[model samples]
Every structure is written in C-alpha cells, then in structure tokens.
Target: MHDSYTEFILPFGSSPNILEEYTNASGGIRTGKLMEHLDSLAGSIAYKHMLGPGVETVGNTKEMGFYIVTAAVERLDMLGPLNPARDLRLSGQVIYTGRSSMEVVVKMETMPGEFDEKEETILLGRFSMVCRDAHTHSARKVHPLAISSPEEQMLYSKGEDMKRKRQTRAQQSLSKVPPNSAEAEALHTYYLKYGQEEELDDISSSSQLVSMGDTRVEKCMLMFPQDRNVHQKIFGGYLMRLAYELGFANGAMFCKSPVRFVALDEISFKLPVPIGSILRLTSHVLHSNASSPQLIHVGVTANVVDVKTGEEQTTNEFRFTWASIDESSQRKVVPETYKEAMLWLEGRRALEMGDEIRGLRTQK
Candidate 1:
C-alpha cells in the first residue's frame, strides 16, 4: 500500500505481553509495552511506504530492506489510561518524510468490545524514524511521500510545522553556555547554592538538598525475543516503557505518594539494544517545580550492559513530567551534589522548554 503514503491499523488484545501487575497504588495496562507496539506499528507503516504499491518480493538486502529505527519521540500525550479488557487499535501512517527519515503519527485508541462503535483515545504520539541499510548500517534514503488530498496536504504541513518547532525548542534547550535569560539566571542562582554549602552524603540532611541516592529508581530486565523488532533489535517503545515506569516510580518516591503522568517531553534513542542484552534502566528525580510543589520531572536513562564483560553503553534517555496524585502531596526537590546539580539543570532546561511551548500553544 505504498504509493507515496501508507496507513494501517494494528489491533491487539489483552495479553501478558502488554499487561503487568501494579506494585503501587496506580493500576493499569503497561504503558511501556503499548509504546513498543506503537513504535512497531509506525515502523511497519514506514516500511510499507518504502515498499511502493505493486512492488512485491523485495530482496532482504542491505540496500533493499526497509529497516528503520526510532530516532526520537517528538511528543506523546496520554489523553487517557489503557483498559485491559479493551482491544488496542493503533492507527498509524507515514505523515511526512525527509532524505533518510520519516515522520509517523500513531493514534492509539481502545475499543471496549469487539463490536464497539466508539473508541477512546488512550494516547497519541509522533515518532521520528530513520531508515538504515540492513548491512552497511548507514542512513538510507526513503521513498518520498506524496500528498494528494487536501487533508493529506494539511497533515503534511502540520508535520513540517511540528518538525520546525521541535528544532527550535531543541536548539533553545541545548545551549552550550548558560542562557542569559531571566529563567536561566534564576536557575544559575539556585544551582550556585549547591556549591556554597558542604555536600550532604546522607539522605537525612536538613538542607534543601535531596539526596541523589534517595531519588534513584533502577529496574533491570532481560530483553526477550518477543520484544524484538523486524531488525531483531529491542523495540524503542519497549525501552520507553521501561523508562516511563521507572520514572513514574521515582516521581512517586520523591513526592511521597502516587504520581500521575502528565506528559512525556522527549525521548531520544541513541543506539538500538540487541536481543538477549541485559537492559538496565535507571531513573532519578532531576528537578521539581519550584512553584508548583506537586509537579515533578524525572529523567530515565536506558543502558545496555554486556552480561559477560559487565560493560555498558547508553541507549536512550526519556524525560517525563508527573503530578502528585494527591493534591495535598507537596514537597520540593534539590540536588545534594555537583553531579546531581548538573542533572537538575538538564531537567530544568527541558521543563522550561516544555513550559514555553505549552504557553505558545495556549496563546494560539
């Protein structure tokens, strides 16, 4: 169904693959697994688009195979929670394309029953995937997308707009030098306090500094064949799920209560994790809203470790925002060491960027 653009629907029923028992107060289908599905579905749509219509029997060669890796998740809004009984319906399409990358928009909804006419949106996300040669492992040019209908044209334009906005926001957040803006100045003064006082080595310190050790939440899992993608690498979405869950737990621990996920800012996949690799996910509370005590930001880092050598390489970094489940849950977070201070700055940068974009969206 590749002509220039292609779309498809993937339906999945509740299974152990996507469901996990909650060890906390929050209970729902595993979101990480759902994200993995979304990534796989998007990759499928991109592959279908590459295999133009009427083109059958494409050889699985480095130059011909349409292997794609998720480069980044621009944004994912969890409009609602996933219900286990409901069948997951992922409607995805190749919305836009560049020289070697394609933009895939996937809308995840759930049908209450087999014959249910109405579906509820669980979450919707935009993924950036780059095509790569199967053997050479380099970026490969993708088939250009064609826009025929006005609706298609509108979506294509919207994709371009989002791309530009992501670029601008990224540039603003990744400045090498500290920004001279008032917000950055404020954060500068805040971080300077860390250097002024003796670093606390324990979690029981009376200072505003929250022990980095206290905020750490680590989860390790064995990557199974079930989570492998077409290329046999661990799915980016699965890594996302792991990061999300760990980040959720970190937020909860920091707030001393259950935390509700509000937004996933940006998730960047640096390298693909191979199947059978030991996946170690580490999450920590990097920053907390200074004004809104209930808002917390956590950073999740995924590392693939060599089981034999015990060496590790970073794979992906996920940033998530969560709010205290209870309105009465209020607390502030501070870094206890220079290392943790740097992490706090990173989180603050992302949080400020998100707030800036959100403000602009509200104005629009």
Candidate 2:
C-alpha cells in the first residue's frame, strides 16, 4: 500500500488560472472535472503499484506487456462541500488485489492551514481496475498486496467484501430475475397509494406525486477522439462527467430548484464507447423524498447509436443522488409502469445505501 501511495495538489486558492479552469458557472468547483482527475490519479496509482514506486512513466505499453483499465467505479461519496477558495489534495493507494484486479481507494481533501493541522476530507471513492495483456487483450495477473498492519488488513477485508456484494447484487439484478415477494408487495402498496387516478384526484391529500416519465432529460452528441483515453476509446471519466451533468440537470428540473450533489451512488461500465460514435445519454428522476432536505435519485444511461440501423446499445449506467436546497420542494416521483416501478425500487435502494454510508461517516 505504501509503495502504491500517490498524491496530487490542486492549488485552486493560490493559482487564479488553475481555479478558473475548474470553476463552474455558479462559482463552485466542477465535480465532473474533478472526477476526470480522480480517474487519472487512480490509473497512475495502479501503475505505480505494478511497476514500482521508482517508475516515473509508463514508457511503452507494448514493451511493458500489461496495462490497466478501469472496470467499474464502486462508489464516490461526498463527505463535505468543496471550497473553491482553498487548495485541495487528492490521494490514494491500492488497498486490495485479486488475480488480475485491484481495489484502489482515493480521497479528496482540503489542504490544511497550518503544518500541524489535519486535512479535512471532502470526498471518498473506490475504483476497480483490471490488468490486461497488451497483446492478447486478456486478463493479466497483478502482484498480490502485502498486508503489514491491522488497518491495512481491515481495508483489504472491506475490499473483499465489496467484491462479494457486487457479485450478489449482479445475481439479484432486476434484468436477470423477477423481484422477490417483499419487493413485489412493496410495489403493490405503492400502486394502490399513488398509481390510481382516483387517489391522484384527491387534492386534499398531502402527497404530490409526479410521473417518473415527466422528469426525463436527454443529450445526444457525437463522440470525438479528443475525449479518448489511452486505449483510444472514449474515456470513462469523460462519460462520467457527461452523465453527472445530465443527472444534475434532470434533478434540477424535477425539483424546480438548484440541487446540491450528495453522492455518486454507482457507475457500471458495461462497454466502451468508440470514437466517432453517436453517444446518447438519457436521465430520469428515479425517486424523490418529500421530507426536509428533500433528496432526488437520478439515473442516467449511456448508449451508442448505430447510425445505419438506428439501434442503440447500452454502454454505461450511472446513479447519483442530489439534495434540493429549497425545503418546500416536496414533489415525489411515481412510476406508472412495471418497468418504471422496478427502477423506482432500485433508486430507493441506492438512496438507502447512501444514507447508511453517510450515517457511518458521520459517526466516524
């Protein structure tokens, strides 16, 4: 872990030009751009772990024999707000390794004021990277991580648990199987409460339900080579930024107010987007909470369009959570079809996980 440790500093406070590049229209830091930096940093850390700390550059992939690619982003949680006036440090290390994959943990923190002052972490994320043989494009074995301390051991254990949980979740995915009895019952109850036209006609009721379909926002563009990664394919970070911006827009439209980004719940890279391809992104408000500090769950799907056939193949799926700034925002999303209902349930699950993770962070 120590060998793979890496850090980079963004002098947003001291360098005006640097800050200008990252600043958004609202004067806050662009989380999407920061995500690109994180992805690059993770890749560097993985290479450092594989090629040793002394290696300055990945000289040649063909000569090096093996290269790494991001398989998935497990989760990225916002622990604190980003302060544009302060310098930020991004750091991480490889905590766990499998036969050909590694779990890299990264954190974004504000630079300390004094020498003795501790940095305040603003974000935490985990990235899954897999090593591939350059020639065969097949999985290549990576060095096993050495566990030297109890803390490191605990982190490794957590990484192992994450992998298992991912497998379990994949097996239980709605695309593969029908919802269990409990989920079915919950959907039935929701339908009875909000799906009926008579129930919707009751203006006296406190519930303000909006159709899930009504909250959709989409963007379509041609993928350019400039956004390509080392593999000559559309960069994962670029795709992430696109999806995030779309989700943010969709959330804002649904809430009718500016929303604060809470967390990037999950991102799955199903396939790579090729250069010069038609990329289409569609986002919808999957779930909404009417409680104080109302939260909205946004889901984005990225697809590559076949120009001749007019067919689209899904390449990625992203889930994000945003919080409405206005306390009075109380519109809840209601699914009208069985497919939408399943998506609603998935969004609710993601929000529940976010809540649990945030609670744990607060306790810590």
Candidate 3:
C-alpha cells in the first residue's frame, strides 16, 4: 500500500491563474472540474501501483502490453465544503486488487491555514479500474496489493465488502426485478398521496409536488478528439464532468434555489463512448426531501447518438445528491409512471446511504 501511495497538490490559494480556471460562477471551486482531476489522479495512482513509483512516463502502451480503464466510480462523498481560498491536496493509494481490477480510494483536503495548522478533509471517493491486455483487449492481471498493517488490512476488507455489495445491488436492480415489499408499499402510499391528479389539483393540498418528468434538463454536444484519453476514446472524467454539471443544473432548477453538492452516489460506465459521437446528457430530479435543508437526488444518463440511424445507446448512468442552500426550500418530486417510480426509489436508497455515511463521519 505504501508503494502505491500518491499525492498531488493544487495551489489554488497561491496561484491566481490556476484558481481562476477552477472557479465557478459563485466564486466557489467547480465541483465537476474537481471530479475530472480526481479521476485523473485515480488513474495515476493505479499506474504508479503497477509500475514503480520512480517510473516517470507510461512510455508506450504497446511496450507496456496492458492498459487501464475506469470500470466505475463507486462513490464520491463531500465531507466538507471546498475552500477556494486555500491550497488543496489530493492523495490516495491502491487499497485492494482483484485479478484484473484495482480499488483506488482518493481524497481531497484543504491545506493548513495560517491560523489553523491542521489540514481538513473535504472529499472522499473510490474508483474502480480494470486492466486490459493491449493486444487482446481482454482482462489482464494486475499486481496484488501488499497489506502490512492493521489499518491496511481493514481498508482491504472494506474494499472486498464494497465489491460484494456492488454485485448484490446489481442483481437486485429494478430493471431485473421488482422492488421489495416495503418499497412497493411505500410507492403505493406515495401514489395515493401525489399520483392522483385530483389530489394534486386540490388547493387544500399543501404539498408543492412536481412530476419527475417536469424537472428534466438536457444537453447535446459532439464529443471531440481533444477530450480523448490515452486510448483515443472519450475520457471517463470528461463524461463525469458533463453528467455532474447537468445534474447540478437540474437540482437547482427543481429546487428553485442554488444547491450545495452533497454526494456523487454512483456512476456506471456501461460502454466506452467513441470520439466524434454525438453525446446527449439528460438529467432529472429523481427524488426530493421537502423538509428543512431540502435534499434532491438528480439522475443523469449519457447516450451516444447515431446520427444516421437516429438511435441512441446509453453509455453511462450517474446519480448525484444536492441540497438546497436555502433551508426553507420545500419542493418535492413525484413519479407519475412505474419506471419513474423505480428511479425515485433508487434515488431514495442512494440518499439514505449518503445520510448513513455522513452520520458515521459525524460520530467519528
């Protein structure tokens, strides 16, 4: 684990030009742009683990015989707000490894301030990377992780558990099976309360519920070669940034207020989007909490559009949670169709997990 450990520093505080590139409209660091950097950092960590730390260049893929690709982003949680006024450090190591896959956990922290001499963690994320044979384009074996300490052992155990949970969740995906009994009952209850047009039309109803379909925000753009990775394909990080920005916009539109990013619940890279493909990103408010400190779960799907055939193939799916900056925001999302209801339940589950993780952190 120590051999694979890596760190990169972004001097946002000291570099005016660098900070300017990352600044959002509101003067805060751009979370989506930060995600791109994190993805790149994870890739670097994975390579450093496979190659020696002293290796400076990847050289040639043909000579290396194997290449890495991001399989999925397990989760990225915001433990604290980003401070553009301070330098930031990104660091992580290869915590676990399978025959052909590596689990890399990366984190972002604010550098110690002049008055406060302790660094503060701001973000934590896990990236799943897979190695493929350069010639055969098949799974390639990766070096095993060396766990020497109890702390390293614990992290390895956690990574193993995460892989198992991912498999279980995939088996129980709504596309493959019906929701469990409790989720079905809850959906029925929600339908009775908000699915009926008559109930929603009643002026006496205090709930400000909006149909999930009404909260959509979309963008279509041509994928350029300039955005390609080493493989000459569209970079996973670029797709992540696009999905995140779309989700953020959808959340803000649904809440009618500026939103603070809470978490990137999950991202599945189904297929490698080719360069020059028309990329379409569609986002929707999948679920919402109307209580104070309103929370919204936004889902985004990225598709590769076939211009000649007028068909679209989904290449990626992303789930993100955002909270309204105004605690008084009280908008809620209601599903009008079975498919939408399933998405609502999935988003709810993601938010619940985020809440549980945050609760655990607070206890620590």
Candidate 4:
C-alpha cells in the first residue's frame, strides 16, 4: 500500500511568459502539451510504485535496472478550458498490473489559485505502460498493485474494463477480418450515406467532393536531446504534440475555419523512437460528423527512419476529435481505398464514443 500511488504538481506563474511553442491559437495551453506532462507524470508514478519499499535509487529496484515505455494513452478527456495562472495538479495510482504491464489512472486538474478549491479536474487519462529489461530490451515483470480501499477497488474494475475494450477495439481494426456485428453494419450504412458517389480525381469541378487526400499533411523532425526521456528514448508526449499539431492543421483546413479540440481518442506507441532518428508524421482527415456536420476526425501516424539506410518503421498512431467554429458547416470525406474506408469507419466510431461519454458527463 505504501507505493500504490504517487502525485506530481506543476505550478504555473501569473504571467504568460511561460507560453510554449505549441500553445493554441488563442494562447491557451495546447492539448498536446498537457498530454506530454501526463505521460511523464504517469511514468514517474509507475516507476515509484514499481520500486515497492526501501528503494533508494530511481534507476533500479531489487538490484536490477529496468526501462518503462508508454504502450498506449487509452483516453484523454478535456473537461473545460485551461487558462494562464492556473497551476496543474496531477495524481496517478497503479490500479491494475499484468505480468509485464501496468495501468495508471492519471487525473489532471487546475488550481485557479492558492486560495481556490482543488476540485477543478480538467483532464483525465489512462496510460498503459510496459516494463522491459534495461540491457536486453526483453519484457520484465512488475510488482503487483495492492488495493485495500473501496475507491481503489472501483478503479481496478474500471482498469479491467478499459483493458478489455482496448483488446476488442484492436481486433476490430484489422482490415482482413470483416466485423459481423450490428454496430459495424450501422457504421457501414452511415459511411455510404455520407460517402461520395464517385472517386475523386485530380481535377474536380465542385469543391464539395473533398477527397481524404486533399487534407493530407506531412512533417518530419529530428529527435534531439531535448525531446528525450530519462531512458534516452524520445518522449511520448513530445511525439504526441507533433501529431496533435499536424492533426489540428489538417482539421482546420478541412473545416476552412479555426477548430476546437474535443478529445484525444487514443495514442498508441508501437515502437520506441531512439534518439537521433528521423521522425516523420503524417496526418489527414478520416471522417466528418454526419449528424452534427461540424465535427471532424483526424488521424496522425508516426514513422521513424534510419538516417543512413533510409529504412522506415511505423511508431505511433494518434487520433484526435475537433469541432468546427461554425456549426452549420457540412463537409464529406470520400474514402479512396479500402484502408481509407476502414479508417473512416474507425473515426466514426471514435466520434460516436466521444458523444456517448459527453452525454454521460452531462447526465452526471
């Protein structure tokens, strides 16, 4: 119980001098920057809890060194606006543990000031982290979480449910296997209703027939020392920022107006990005809200390439939800290939789920 949970605090100054490179257009904190902080805080919580008791050094536990890498950011929900002069308080607890994985529930809230209430929870995130041997990069066992309270029990249950949902979603994402369910059928119907009648060519007279290709954006950056974590690998949050910025740009273009970030559905880290690797990010529109017409979904994927050989490997996938400034705006994304069709379907599912979550919150 002594190492079951950990907390971190990031106090903000009164002035706007701390403005970061990724601030939103209105000068508010960018969602990607918040995610970067969450990843680092979650990793710290995992490290602290894995140490059990009587571990002095942060690099080792039980006389063996290990490495922790973010496997996935299951979900990140932004409840309200975060402004300057608001300090952030982050708390993380190890709710569930597997043979080589740990699920940390991280809550981020803003303190209006020193004299204000601390109940303003702005973001809540769930991170899945995997432990590995420092030398061999092989999977390593982690200390099991100790739960002794009812609240902890409830969180443990939720962790289990999230894990199961992740597995189901991953299985559903496979392109080869056709999903045989009512939900999948409904998604297919929705796509056809919003889909274009013909494939978009290079020259289209009407601007309404916007191909998914038109919103495509590509960015490349070198993983420098500043972007690395304690393990010498590129920080998950930095990569998240890159993906988010690209997605934001693409969504803004798709909507032809400024957009507001709604949620981050998921960010999956498939492989570790070593320092000095050339990281490439590709972003494009996946779907648009058929019912609301003002919401759009963007997909951002990351790849790493060897500087010398030019060999490339996929690293991460970041999914974002954005809302157009004008509620009356209507746009359709036409899928050009089967893979693109699947991405569109997935985006629809993400938007639907986000709506459900928002609905539940409203009810509460």
Candidate 5:
C-alpha cells in the first residue's frame, strides 16, 4: 500500500491533516475563477507540508516550484451527445529526475457524481517539472526525505516507468505535427494578436513582456495540493494559476529579469483537478517582437491526472503576455535566443491574418 512517483519522496502514507479538498460544483455551489482554486490548493499544501519538519529549509521557496510541462496524454472517450456529464480526478507522480529537475506523471479523469457515467476517461498526460530557487519567494531544494520512506520508493519506481512513456510522447507531439497544422498556425496568429492588444488594469502587475534579446531563463513556480475544495475535489483555479505562472515565466525569460503578470486571456475550465493528483505545468516562449515597449507572449497549458486510476482529471490552455520597463537604455528589449524561429513564424501568420481581416473590412 504505497504510492509511487519517482526520484523524490511524494510524502505519502503520512498524515499532516488534509490540506484541501474539492467536490462537484453544481447549482452555484462554487464561484470564482479557476486560478483561485489553484491558489487555495497550493497554499493549503505549502502551509502544512513543505513547511514541516524543516520550517527553516522550506521557508519562502515559491519560485523554486516553477513547473514546466514536458509531456501529456488524454484518453478522451467520445460521449457523443448523451447526458454529457463528466467527472475528473488528478494525480502527480515523478517520472524523470535530473540533477536539479524532475518530470511528473500527470493525468485527469471524470470524477463520478450526478450525471457522471461509468467508463469515461477524458484525458491522460505527463509533464516536466523543473525545481529551482532563482525567481520565487525563497531558497529552494526538493525535500530529500520528501519521499524517503519505503512506501515512497514504490511511487518513485512507477514514476520512472511513466517517465519513459511520457518522454516518448513529448518527442512525438513536437516532431510529428502535421505539415499544414491549422492548430499551429492558429496558435501563432492568436498569440500575435493577443500580444498586440492586451492591456492590464490589475495594478498587481509589476512588469510585462515586450521583448526577448536571447537565451532561456526560468520564470514562475506553481504548486498543487492533495486536497482541493475542502468540501469536494479540486477547483478550476489550479488551472488558472498554472497559466499565470507560465506567463510569468515566459515574461521573465524574455526580459531576463523578474516579470509581473497583469492579465489572462480566454481561460475555460474544461475539467477540475483533484487533490493528491500530480499537476503538470508549462510555460513556453511563444512570441517576442517590436522594440519600444516590446511585447513577449507565453503560452500555458496544464494537465492533471490520477496516479492509481491512470485517468485524466484536468486539462486547459491559456495565453499570457508579460511587460517590462527598460532601465539601461530607457527602452524595452527582449532577448531572443530560443524564440527566434517560432516568433518569426508567428509574426508571419499574424501579418497574413491582419491582411485578410482588413481585406474583408474594406469589402464591407
């Protein structure tokens, strides 16, 4: 009776008081966006566990938690168009371990309730999570004893098996895309437009993405808890936070400095993440262009899945733009190392779309 992930201790079989929990949201049972749920789940977990046994060691290590997704898979059964109800459960298990980074096995499912039917799996996936202590709120290190128990060893082994599969999938997704992928083209155009227009009113933001001179820098850390709503499973907020961190990371990567998050675009909680499920988070450099208040856009996608059931519990995608103020030259600059080709391609598509839209507008 042991939960297994990989490399590190998942800290299972231990009791530290359920940090959070979530249930089905119906008839206004839940309110607020998905990011809030992520916040609550992560907050509850950090408050209780990461801070345990060695409060001094775990103190203020938020940035160390920035998680990058490397792989994902979903079963996605065809419900067709029946009652059309769904359920979700999520799990995070370590699949790969580097010197300082690790990958987690993430999945999602239809948690049974109300209209929830039997034998339905919506999504399955895996992700890469890099643990570092540079950009977050404090010093960082993965808990050595985090999975030191005999029970944890088993979870770690399972995670290793999953790592091989997940790595395979990640490579396939990147290399095997269609030649004329509408999805890829659409993503490029959408991001370009999003980069141009989005403005922030949320003063909470300290900076934004405008440029990328070069190189890749790590940004944003995200955390998920085993308990979600305290009443039910997990909330959509976890999804949003994943997106936010992705944006934050991308923005910082572009500027090579800390970036503040101002706004999120078109976030929909297709599914809910559950407590105890591992979360896979990703932040990628999408596009960075134009000087003088340059703009850099980052994309965020999250997948949560069940560890025991091998089912998917959460899936969502979002776009984020981070901005910054140039200090030395008094002008914004974006470092464009890993993002050159992608950014150029995105710009080309956006330019095409703009031309088409303008052509249509003139016809009218």
Candidate 6:
C-alpha cells in the first residue's frame, strides 16, 4: 500500500470502471461521488499507509480477532472557482501513537492521484483510533508509532496540535457529571466507563443476544463473487448490506408491520471477514417504547470468521443498531420473558447515555 498512490485509482467509483462510470455528470467532479469517494478512503488508507510497518501482524491472526480503532475526519478544500475540474487527492500520514491509541494526519484535495509537493492540500484532518485484542473483543494497548522520517515528524507535530485543540474543546464542552446525577450517569455510563468483567457480555452467547421469541429471524448470506478482489476480501458495503437486510427482517417481524430504518445508533467493525466466509447475522429486539410514533431499538451483530482457522482469533464481530417505525394498528403478542427484561435494561442504559451525551453536546 506504500506504493498505492499509483496502484489504487482504487475503487473510487461505485463500479469496476470508475473513470467511465463517474463521468462528467457525477457531481461535476467537485463533490458528490467525489465526496463519498474521499469518505471511503479514510479507513483503508489509515490501515495501509498510516501505520508504520508490521501492520499485517497486528491486523489479524488465529488467537486475536481484528478490531481496529477508527477515527473521524471531515472534508477539506473547496476550490469552488479555482480549477473546478481538477481531480482531487487526499493524503494521510501516521502522526503519533500511545499505548492504546494512534493518530493520523489526513488531508484531501483537488489534484491528480500522485502525491507530490504540487499536490496542494484540499482539507486537513486527523483521527485517533484504537486496536483491541481479539478474544475479549476489548481495546488493547499497541506499540508506539514506528516512524522516524522527516515527513513523519512533521505530520506528528501537526497531529499533536490538532489533538490538543480537540482535547481542550472536549473538556470545556462536556461538563463533569455529579456522582448522584441519575440522568447523567444513566446516559453516559456505557460510553464513558468500561464494563466490568462480570458485567461485560460475550458476543457468541445467545444469552446476551435478544430474542425474536416465537417470531422468526430472517438472515441472508450473500457472497458477491463478482465483487471479489485479488486478496479475496469482501467489500465493507457488501457486508453492510447483508447486515441491514438481517436487521430489517428482525425489525419487521417485531413490528408486524412495515418498518423503516431511522438511524444507525452505533456501529463498530472489529475485523475484516473474507469474501467467502459465512456472516452469521443475529438481530433481536433490545427494547421498544410507546412514543407518539413507537421506536423499537434492535441490536444486530454479525460474526464472520475464517472457518479454516477454527480459532478465536479468526472471527470478526460487527455491532450495529437500527431503529424502526412501528405504524401497525395491529400488534403481535409480544413475549415478556427474561431476555426481554435484560434487553430492556440495556436499552434503558443506552437511552440514558444518549441523553447525557446530547446534553453535554448542547451545553457546549
């Protein structure tokens, strides 16, 4: 991937022929597919180029599952009037690393695919991500960054500046909650605090998974053979499709009516599943409430692992949430069992956390 600047014209478009498909009509080349294209590049670029070396050793193995920490970035550069037709380029460099987290410097631009001084910067952003141990599916410490280049040094300094600014803002914006603040504690607990060993749940256990009860859970196993790459890896979007499909069925079954996807509450991609691997998707009702328009929170987790390894290290877990709209005048005989009660507790906890986060964000 170090030489990817030339190799990766790279799935920039939705089709095999990005150049022909993303013709002059696609967002006038300034935005649109270009924006989406840039957005998709962050993870791949970070994993491939931002990391120093030995990324493969850290990525996946038999004992440790893959869960790479990810960072967020925003778009930069809007050459609105100047050279509007230019093909943009984005750049990222590994900046800094700590025991558990790493930061990368990312930039976007309206230039050719090549990386040169002439490749003027479009937008500049950075990310802080963490990689976790596979068996426990928990965040773990990592080696400090391995870069010693002048270019790396420069990027590291810039990333540190960004990090400081972000920390200051986060600190000022989110006020500390009092220990007795019920609303605050409920809303921020899962997010702000780590789960205890006893409290933490396993992904493979059906006990932790919600139940459809007597209702059926729908699952679709899709292998996009045509979408296969030389490395035999499946596209993230491909897996995402199967995931949402499974989630849609769970929601539809529970609602017993037409359902619509409202939001992606939380999503985490722990490891990369190969193209042919089976994606065992499970979705169950976390909980639901009677709002003016009812909101049902469904939890979907996809476990896709390499059957060849047959070890804890080969599996990748993805967790996501989908909210559905329940407009059915008719309702099914929903079961009120032990699992439902636990799910209700989890949902309640999530709601409180969300409320607190929003409160903190707004208080800014």
**lDDT (Cα, tens digit) per residue for candidate 4, span 1-364:** 3375666666553545455543566877777787778888788777877776444457643346787889999888878767556767778877888899888888877766766755588777889999988878889998877787898888878888888888888887746566558656765675565454543443255455577777789998888988888777788988887888889899988888888888889988999899988999999899887565488999999999887898889999999999888777677777777778778778878998999998999899
- Between the candidate structures 1 and 4, which one is better when assessed by lDDT? 4
Worst-scoring 10-residue span by lDDT in model 5: 74-83
lDDT scores for all predictions? 0.72, 0.89, 0.89, 0.79, 0.41, 0.47
Candidate 6 C-alpha lDDT tens digits along 1-364: 2321211232333233555554543233323344343434545544554344345433443244444545333113222222343554555655666666556545555454333325554444444556656567566676555555787667667667766755653453323322335534543453233233333232124232223354435353655566542234555545545555566667666665545444334444556566666666666666554443455566666666455884433233222333344453223222244344444455544444444544674597
Clashing pairs in 4: none
Error of 4 at 118 (Å): 6.4
Candidate 5 segments whose C-alpha is farther than 4 A from its true place: 1-227, 305-314, 327-364
Better of 3 and 6 by lDDT: 3
Best-matching candidate per TM-score: 3
User: Which structure is stronger by lDDT: 2 or 5?
Assistant: 2
Per residue, candidate 1 scores C-alpha lDDT tens digits across 215-294 of 78888889999987657688676777778878877887787777777678788889889899888998888787754546
Q: Which pairs of residues collide in candidate 2?
A: none
Ranking by TM-score: 3, 2, 4, 1, 6, 5
Please provide, for model 2 over 1-364, each residue's C-alpha lDDT reduced to its tens digit, 9 standing for 90 to 100: 7889999999997788999999998999999999988988899999999999998988778889998999889899988899887899999999989999999999999987535456899999999999999999999999999899999999999989888888898898888888888878977888887888786555335346778877778899999999988778899989999998999899988888999999998888888899999999999999886557999999999999999999999999999999999889988888878889889989877888888888887798
Comparison by lDDT, 1 against 6, better one: 1
lDDT of 5: 0.41
lDDT of 3 by residue, 245-308 (tens): 8898888877788999999999998889999899999999999966469889999999999999
At residue 263, give the lDDT of candidate 6: 34
Residue pairs with backbone atoms closer than 3 Å in model 1 (clashes): 32-241
Worst 10 residues of 4 by lDDT: 194-203
- How many clashes in each candidate? 1, 0, 0, 0, 74, 11
- Tell me the TM-score of model 1: 0.81
3 Cα displacement, candidate 1 (Å)? 6.4
